[model samples]
Target chain A: MQRRFGDQEVDICIVGAGAAGGVLARDLARAGLKVVVLEAGPFWDPQQDFASDELSMQKLGWQETVLVAGNNPLKMGHNNTGRGVGGGTVHFTGVFLRFHESDFRVYSQDGVADDWPISYADLAPYYDRIEREIAVSGPKHFPWGPFAGPYPYPEREPLSANAVVFRQGCEKLGIKSAVTPLAILSAPFDGRPPCINRGFCNQGCLPNAKFSTLIQHIPQAIAAGAEVLPDCTVTQVEVDEKSRRVTGVIFVHDGTEYRQPAKIVILANFVVQMPRLLLNSATPAFPDGLANSSGMVGKGIMPHSSYDVYAKFPEEIRLYKGTPVLATTQDFYETDHTRGFVRGYTLHAHGARPVAMATGISVGAGTWGPQLRRAMLDFNFYARITQVGEVLPSEKNTVTLADEKDDNGLPLPLVTFGYGDNDLKLIDHAVAKMKEILTAAGGKPEFVIPDTAHLMGGCRMGADPRTSVVDQWGRTHDHPNLYLAGAPIFVTGGGVNPTETVMALAARTADHLIQQARRGL
Target chain B: MATKSHYPHYNVLDAAEDWDPHTRKIVEARLLPLESVEHLTTAETKTLYSVVAALIDDDRSEILDYVVKHFDDTLGKRIGESQRKTGVPPQADLIRRTLSGLGKTARDNYGKPFPELTVDEQHTILGQLERGQIPADGIWMNLPQKEAFTKLLSLTVEAYYSHPKIWSEIGHGGPAYPRGYVRTGPGLVDPWEAQREE
Candidate 1:
């Protein structure tokens, strides 16, 4: 019953069917290039596979063995990332905000992290194209766009009570707030239905209203002659011994190994696995790892540090009645050194599920038994505002190969992480601001949920070959045909969700490859 | 008779999806649908039962008996499986060692094993373990006593909440599938959810 792919050759081979890989596959296939998308996890139909269950969602992440080390331990195989063909997009809350212009010129503006090789202007057209393709809903005049482009779809109406409360708090604090732009459909577009406000966005959106890569790009790629082989784990990206060009990829499918040759190879397996795969593919020609001559493959790993301030009101708020994160206050998004942090964060209304809240309370809410019972009774009366803060890239926080091996006999990725001093200051300031805003809205501070969101950096992109892994076009400096397509190419992670930017970067890279092919490179 | 409810309009189990495989599997796991105890030794089962009885409410002897088996199976699989040396001992060894240490402490102090001790005596020993105030020469000296206590407490809490009876008491809308929430906006509750007690 197992399908097999032999030593076949293709014009393009993308190693992850994620947000990036899906987009890249679609673009390349549409451009008349033969594309093969090799996904480690199976492609699941939303209606057939997804359900609003906590335990099932718990098992959705990469369950293969991974080691957590360093001062701040990473919660691997958790909600951190997904393993399905759609990748993390399948389970995301659909908050798709564009990176600000300053996000690219971080080194120049803040004198902190290295500046990205490409600016927001370079990515704006792709962002617009993707927004239209994904049918993103936002305000009539979206105020947050650094380039300030109009949204293709109308804004989702009737903001959830949780979002309203957050807006009220922002108004009380005299801070700027707006409806968060989301990739979730607001109106029926391109034959897909609009969001029904089911509230279980993280459970993979069974209604298919959310614009995950599963629903958006992967199908288009398949339709346009791309071969998407799901449940195929790429073990190594084989390179020509003399030319140092990526020749093909070796993969395992259903316990059988196969080599699929490629004219161009793209690695888009998110952050951790992308670096891990490259490191595992180290040949005698390039011992440090493929495309790792800069020694920057698994360095500067940044997981966005986040904090939440929950509040309890007298009236029934029913926080989990709509989309999880529908609105936010980005007044503190820009940098201000007076706050003792180089960069800032955005505070968004977080509509958490009852079970998620219960788990949060059970873990560290400082209440137990009878007291916990009282809190659970008033579950609908709770609302939270979470700070998605920016984290500076540091070489110390890295993803290295662990000595322990997984089920496939591959070395487990050891994620070593610790909060930088600036990151701590940023968190402290955000918490204080959130507490103040909540108090002004006549709400009592209940508890704080400290965690990280959206992993980024590692194989960062820059103009300088010495300090970076890939060029502005996501082509690895060491190899002509090898490319990276996800957040791993980010120079500095912004104070918001990075999926939209990741998609934009992927589109840009795909365009570059297509243009190069047209010029007969 | 069925328990009188504050939220009389809502069916607490309306969210439980029988049609969806993922939700159904989760429901089965949460319910701990087991025919018999497969993993726990007789003594280990007795100790866990005693601990659960002390930590959670005592009204349900039926639920605790079943819940302990799930705990036992989970602990058996997880113990010594951790790749990282996270300062805590393996979960299986942690349970066994902690139980033995508690008994030793009880016998040395009150001339009885933990199960036979009075509620106050049990509380005293547990409180010391929780606070990491156990003496350096105590039986739990080698272990991260506070962390072990927390780990056990968390497990007990998880097991306690997994049942439907506890969910009803806590006013939870059990599952949300098949009939997914239509009223997900602010101040709106679906017919199946708990009504506000006015």
Candidate 2:
């Protein structure tokens, strides 16, 4: 069940095993290159891991090791990321959508943002490759977005009855809706089972149907003879000023120190950790940080303009009986000036079971005992209306090294951000629409819980080396051989799941990384 | 009780459909429906018992009682009013048995947060429930307070997963838009990872 590598050096060093890091590690390793991935977490096995009991999940650090940093406070402020070998991709919702062509050029189009160095056309093929490699499910022909290749209809997990009804509501509004493109295995494909829709995905899939890098990419990396060190935490990327390069990475495992030297380094540690890691690795040449030439490694933070709406319907319907997340409405995916919000909002929809529903609506207190026992019966009749809006880029919304240190004596990353007035306006707008839909379905507000998902930013992408940490290829301006991957490089939070885009970008960089490695960069 | 209520899915469930607006695919353990849930899940169950034991060790009886009393919950006010109306509250022993099963964990039987944001918002939510703000698709439980433990628990362990972080000693994390960022603040060594060697 375990493999050993005493002192192995490699062609590439992948810092994290999340979406981008995992995929890149697998691809490069398959190319017969010696790859080493240092993950600062545990590796969960499907057979021996993934418990369904709620109590276990709570105690097991929610199956995530990306422990509490100073940045996110209040509520479930941080979307849980797997600290284990698979990383965030293990816990992702598998909703894969291409970045709208305009998404790459929001600044040019809307005069509100900076453009990604790569265009939609340039990254289109990588998207297709990832779609096929990961087995994405969706219509090949998307009428809304422009991209190459035919839609690979991978799998469609069972749609809950309520999801169908919600589709009707979207149609009634005449919004452009499509079968969500997802990484969830719809049928038995690539040695994985089909999704049976137990809707406990966030807890980790018992069935191999969900597309986690741990299942898909990491295994491939191993088969290609790559060294994946799970439970290994990379602390700093040691800089060599004489060579103007990253000579090695210093980390701790058990109680030992490890120095992983590599020709090429990829800072794929996600948006949050990317900046912190880089900032934590301060040197004489880069006293500010590793790639602090711009002082922008932790700037331009944007949490998905995340918000939610809930309506209590008149039915004992079980929402948690279906997929953890089914259909997401990206009807307003592209930015429209009319909406008052610069980046538009993507509507994510779902229902819940009695316990889950009670969790949401049970935010209030009532008489305990018999009085409480009769409280409205099973909270079966409710739906959760949620939206992910684009939070505008602001240097003020940044992730910095907090004064407090972790157990490792490293400064804990502090995420400082607040919803601005514009965000408030957008939430108000989103709430109105959500209310209308809920009321139309004959539901009324028991309450609304506003929260954000995919907490992004702290690291952003741009063309200006002085203003941005990474270029369009996700290469750090300061460290040419090093690349930054994950949602942190996201310049702006798109109105949809950023996983697909992250994969596409990683794939594109994988090709470039191969070229550079071949050239002996 | 139902008004111009359009459809249950859109209003309460936030239903999302990929192919059509009327159907959904619920993926499970790949077994045919009923047979699937029948399979004994040793992993989650074993882990659950351990967590329960730990919770009980923490001596948090209040939380256990809350989840037990509120389990199999019908969020509307019908259950409460019915219990009060029946006038015969259930025995204390039943509560003890149920609480013993849950072990100890914080239960937000009381309104948590947004309670302090505004009094009006708090009262409005409670008022709606008491004054029949119940949604149409909802099932009403008419149980005598103490005796009609029609269903003992409404939710599974997963239902309470979001509780400890939101309403307890643990806090939320990450940078971006954190709902509740844990400020282990400056100068304090994070005891959570204290075991991790430097």
Candidate 3:
């Protein structure tokens, strides 16, 4: 039976129990506030439910139908973003890197995209706190992004054969490479064992070594008096007609509708769902949608335009034995207009599993029958380098309500995206650079897989109410009590994974809420 | 009795046998026959088998039977139900129409059905279909022939590779569960993993 709450009232009601929601839940509940998190998916225990299957993990990703259209259309939903209590963190490869100082002032520095309302300095403390809280492991003194201190845990040792070969290429090409900062524990910390290098981090680590919010934050939050309601879909956010303040959220659990009243409502659902929820909550006073006074709620959706370059080697590499994405080089992370691109892309060695490799060889390698069979036999000799590049915000690349409705009778999200000229140039340069790196390591570049890694933007935060949805604190200008969390607040997506920054901003938002509550909010 | 030469180290349910109970269930669930095949007609299933056999260069009737059944079971109900902008037909209809087009191509080019064509002839017909070289007014026109071939080929390859016998031949590590990796440093191999004989 689905657990039902009788009170239907809490000091704070969070929409999604993802990276941001998990942090907010623990922090808010620990601050003595009655917090409740509504997760639209099941909560799986790591040790009990994790596995090493590609098919199962694909299902764990959001599979519900989403309409994607543009000059360069994207395959959304299933292939990207997880659908569970831990959200994307459940299936994340755990490459957590801090945003560069240039990431904060992209607009001011490059004359493109809007600069973040809050600086990196403002979010530095939270990043340090989250890294310490999660026991992040990395190289001790990496001259990459600015950080307050060294990694909380020691670095993961003995890089994968794929990374070793890729690093040889990096050295030959004069690119600085380092041990990727990872949430996967490198040593025993807080009773959790170190990573055994299971090679299935993308498939949900069974050993509980990978730091998913499901393993840490959710449990702490539950212990700190935060109620977690899984398998519950929030359909609409009801607001007071006269005051325009969010009254409560109407959700469906086990086919039964429940209205949970709250003093504050936080939408921490990943990029796509967050904007969909806001647009679905249109009221008479706010027809364009609640907290969408600027009409920027679902606009400017950006999932980093990414691609993968795979190379064939003469000898076996056994790229699948270690953590997926064991090493990453951000040498190309900073923009250089001389390189013929306005922004840059981060290139990393891909730790692809057997099933993923088989699929890639069959489709991407351009072989079939006896040749395909030979390629599959030679799978151990291939290595992949992935590019995660920034895409400047465009008014056209957006998330809107689809014509079709979901199982719950709510309209599905329709994402329309197209690569800009600058994006195309960056992708071309990144792919060429990756090929050069592979060539330097005595491997032949084989194929390219056009894909996106992280999703950001829609419901972006800014100081101007007329131009952006939420303020720097993630507080919506229309509803002072309503706040947004996670990648949706990013004014500009950095050339790195967005998970660490999402958690950091959540910490900052929680502090903001605590300060506001002290002022009788 | 001599040990089997082909699939010499085959375990019928390697993943299930190696994985913990929970992980085993997940792997087992996919292996079970999908209920979606009930939506396809017996003739449609037969056509799928023949087309898949031609595409993958598999002549064994049983392999063709298993491949088509697996594809139908997994994706029969959803085919042709939704159309992406890429022009790939709905899952069900794509299989139906593509097979229909292949049979027509076989008849038009060599005056024989696809299943009756020689292996080389079958490859010729498939190549034309894959390259979008088939006549414009026919079945392959409306469908994205290349994308359709890609989708079908991918599914066929997945089904073939997923079998226990193939796992042995390809030297896969099977499932990682209670026994996760330990010797995972650069070029390191665990004792249990498949070692390439010199």
DockQ winner:
3
Model 3 chain A TM-score equals 0.97
List lDDT for all candidates, in order. 0.78, 0.57, 0.79
Sort every candidate by TM-score, greatest first: 3, 1, 2
Off by over 4 Å in 1: A1-5, A145-149, B1-10, B14-33, B49-167, B182-186
Each candidate structure's TM-score, on Cα atoms with residue i matched to residue i, is: 0.90, 0.71, 0.92
* DockQ of all models, two decimals each: 0.31, 0.03, 0.33
Expressed as tens digits, the lDDT of each residue in A1-521 for candidate 2 is 23254455556888998888888998898777778888877788865656432323322222221222223331221153456777767666677878888887888988876787778888888887888887777655554668532556643645554555455557677765555677887777887877766555665666777798888889888898888888777889988887667876888887577888877788787766788899999988888998788888888777665555656655533344455466667767676678776667777666443334443333322222222222323233456667777777778777677665655788766566666666677778777777766666566755665556675656677789878888877788887677788888888776677888888888888888777667675
Query: Would you list the rank order by lDDT, best first?
Result: 3, 1, 2
Docking class of 2: incorrect
Residues A400-449, candidate 3, lDDT per residue (tens digit)?
88777777888878788898888889999999999999999989987677
Q: B95-155, model 1: which lDDT tens digit per residue?
A: 7777777777878889977778776677678778778877747576788787667666666
Ranked by TM-score, the better of candidates 1 and 3 is: 3
Across A1-521, the per-residue lDDT of candidate 1 in tens digits comes to 24333466788999999889999999999999988889988888876677665434644566665566777776554446777788888888899898898898888999998898888899989988889888889887665647454678888767888888788888988887888889998899888878877778887887788888898799999899888899888999999879989998989988888888988999999788989999998988889888898999999999988777788876667766678898887788899877777988888888876557765675555454445556766776777888889999999988888776666778867778899999999999999888888777777878887777778989999898899999999999999999998999999999989999999999999889889999874
> Which candidate number maximizes lDDT?
3
